[model samples]
Target: MTKLYCLPHAGGTPAGYRTWIKALAPEIEVVPLQHPRPSDDEPLSLQEAAESVVEQCETDEDFAFFGHSLGAVIAFEAVRALSGPPRRLFVCGSAVPPVEASRGRDLRSLPDREFLQEVARLGGLPPEIHADAELRQEFLPGLRADYTLAETYEYHEGPPIPCPVSAFRGLSDGHVDKDGLRRWGEFTTADVTAREVPGDHFPLRTSATFLHRAIRKDLAA
Candidate 1:
């Protein structure tokens, strides 16, 4: 079986990819990974997160990586850190390319209410959490930490990973336009394929079928 490691979006957990395990069954083993959460005393950095992800993988074996939003950058960094590269890299919903990338805005300093509102605007926050104050409180810290990593990301031009890159963007995603999606091509020497799925920034919710079908087709190839 080919392992398909999945990294989640900001404030997202392994559970986010739970359904993928079943969806891409027997042939592709979906291994959803979690980045470290920030503690009050210490915050998690993107490099640390990438190193942590690298440690979790079986570098000796063949595998592919799929990442969404914030996870996309982390996965790209992890791929760079790997001694052995993945078969392919699927980056979804990320507008910023890895070269000199830094998602604009200081979301880390926004007031709790405003911060949540901003993330919600980007379709990063869940409606259930937004409606529940307690859930919001519980979720805020990690979200902020992840956002910090994203907002502070500074990509130095390094050798592009020796793997084909597949970029996916949601048609209705206000954050990512066609030109931004095309920028991913700069990071890879191999072929780069870009597909626009139907939805807003959150493809899993609005267009899982299209997303899965595209992934299945790539994996099959």
Candidate 2:
């Protein structure tokens, strides 16, 4: 049985995949990577965080990666660092070859209110969370830190990976343009495919059946 390592987007907790895991096949062991923060422990640079994931996956039999947004970029880099190849790599809601905005930058410098506004503009955070003052304060710092790490990530130019790559995006995703999504093909030697689902960036929540069928088909191939 192959292991499926799941990585969450910026400001996303491991809990994000709880439902998806239950929906996946039992043969696929799901391991969600936890990003280190000041509250969680010592903070890790994006590269360090990716290295940690590769380290933990070292003992697995066979593996695959599924990452969303910021996590997609990290999963790409982690596979590059691996001692061996994974069975497949699925990157959703993220661009490949690393876009400038996807690289780590210090977004924490922004005023909290402005930061939340910027995130809302990006289309991931819920409007309700933004409306509640207490919830906004509680979630803002972690979101900023995650965005900073993502903005600062630097992509290394290298030979294409030997594994199959699947890039997924929503038809209405405001963040990932088609050209950016197509760039993902350049990273793989195996067949590369791109899919557009029916929702915004977080299509898995609304189109889980479609996502699952597509992934299951790819994994079987």
Quote each prediction's TM-score: 0.93, 0.89
TM for candidate 1 is 0.93
lDDT tens readout by residue for model 1, 1-221? 77999999888888988998998888889999997756668766787889899999987876999999889989999998888889889999887555426556798899999999988987788788889999999999889988888877777778878998889988988777778888888888887889999887778777878878888888777
lDDT of 2 at 142: 76
lDDT of each: 0.84, 0.78
Number of the top candidate by TM-score? 1
Per-residue lDDT of 1-221 in model 2, one digit per residue for the tens? 66788888877877777776777768666777766543345655677778877886744578899888888877888888887789999988987746745445455678987778778887868666778999888877778778767766666788888789888898899878777777888788888888898889787677778877887788877
Point out the worst 10-residue segment of candidate 2 by lDDT.
Answer: 35-44
Question: RMSD, each candidate, Å?
Answer: 1.6, 2.4
After superposing candidate 2 on the true structure, give the runs of residues whose Cα lies further than 4 Å from its correct spot.
Answer: 38-43, 100-106
Q: Cα miss at 6, model 1 (Å)? A: 0.5
Evaluate model 1: give its lDDT. 0.84
Please give the lDDT score at residue 26 for candidate 2. 81
Alpha-carbon shift of residue 119 in model 1 (angstroms): 1.7
